[model samples]
Target: MSTSPTTLIAVPDSLDTGTPPAPAGRRWQPQATHWAALSIAGLLLSWWALTASGLIAPLFLPPPQAVLARFGELLAGSYMDATLPQHLLASLQRMLLALLAAVVVGIPLGIVIGVFPLARHLLDPVIEFYRPLPPLAYLPLIVIWFGIGEASKVLLIFLAILAPVLIATAHGVASVSPLRQQAALSLGASRWQLLRHVILPGALPEIITGVRIGLGAGWSTLVAAELIAATRGLGFMIQSAAQFLVTDVVVLGIIVIALVAFALELGLRRLQQRLTPWHGQPH
Candidate 1:
């Protein structure tokens, strides 16, 4: 009830007078997900437009609707000679078994390459020689050796994936910060202890990067390998479709491959996150 000429009284809180929290209005947060969606939609629209404008023949490039119909039919168990599900199952199985073998072999080799300079030097020439060779290059020999059976197909994918994983492992180990290694050594840690605890964790991010590369290689090799003596696979389905000019089946196969590959990548990313929480861009 007391009045002065615009007088004020204040109570002090325990908090210190410090810099204000950053304005929530930080400039330019990107709409990354939206941009990605737009890009995908644009590609699809281009594909549709080109197919519609007579720039491409329907036989070679079916419309999206036609491809959708074919994919539906495949899901409904309506296909020739072999059901679509059976072909998909065959392809997935071969890819998985080969991927498993690659992991088992590649992880150890990667550890060796990463940990031992001499080992890397010794393997460099051999790796360089084979890395560029298409897994298909061995198709004829694989046919002779494994005779169009599952073994041959699995081996092809295995060869394609193993190198990437091993090299990646080596790359990861080598990429670990030198200061980190020095610190461990200064703390009287042994080499094994350093690798087990520090180097491996630090390198895991790159190792995952390598695995993703290998997965792509593995997917491509699967299709190539299945093109050989396999009776049932998405590649086989596409091959069979081409004989009758059924572009729809081919499109459907490609879509399935893309979807499966995307799913695998997502799963692998999640697994990497769980296993190597420390190995990535800082939060």
Candidate 2:
């Protein structure tokens, strides 16, 4: 039989869509640096406007310049008995110690709670009861139990950080995809191997997030922790400054705390990205 008459249709080599999908709306998106700078500038301008205009007394809300001067003074010489570096070092030492202890104890306990319902049921009530209590509320008990020394301060901060880390880790571990676990099992993975290769890796992002949150809680509790008869800490310095109505110094202390906490958060974020490089990546 004769084949159907040969027929062909022309096809364009490339569709050549008009505009590239990428770099369209994204190009107009605000850069983080620009937005951060703008926000800082706006806050400073508003602060200056309010204070310089005499709408708010300098005593209550000192001008940014005054706070800056106070910061310089603190950095150059002693604010109270302890110099800026001394106070900062003391605070950092306590925070680091507390954070280390929390991480060590919290991660394993979290894993246990996440992996076993019995553990969760047994421990969750105790964690829940204590987690909501303000650090200040328990400060007295901590001081009485641990004594009003470095132990009390560190212990209080540790407790403040522990609950969040534990909860985060448990949630993260529990949220690990069952498919991933099954895949690991199908590959002849032992329980320990599955935990090491699949479960831990999958839970890392959430654990890191929980650590971030825990750090925040720890910082907020720092002042209270230092309230335990501290002679050298940012908290003590600020408290003394406030008692004496040294608002400039108080403001400077606040700024220092903010800057330090911001640095910590940035550091943790970088660490998390390094550890979980696959996170947030497009397929």
Candidate No. with top lDDT: 2
Error of 2 at 50 (Å): 1.6
- Cα TM-score per model: 0.83, 0.88
Q: How do the residues 173-282 of candidate 1 rate in per-residue lDDT, one tens digit apiece?
A: 88888998999999998988998988878878877888888988998887788877778888888877888999889888888888898999999999888887865457
- How does candidate 1 fare on TM-score? 0.83
Per-residue lDDT tens digits for candidate 2, residues 1-283, read 2222222522232236544333223435567999999999999999989988999988899999998877777776998887888889999999999999999999999999999999999999999999999999988888778898899999999999999999999999999999989998999999999889999999999999999999999999999998889999989889999899989888888888888999999999999999999887752
Alpha carbon lDDT of residue 109, candidate 1? 85
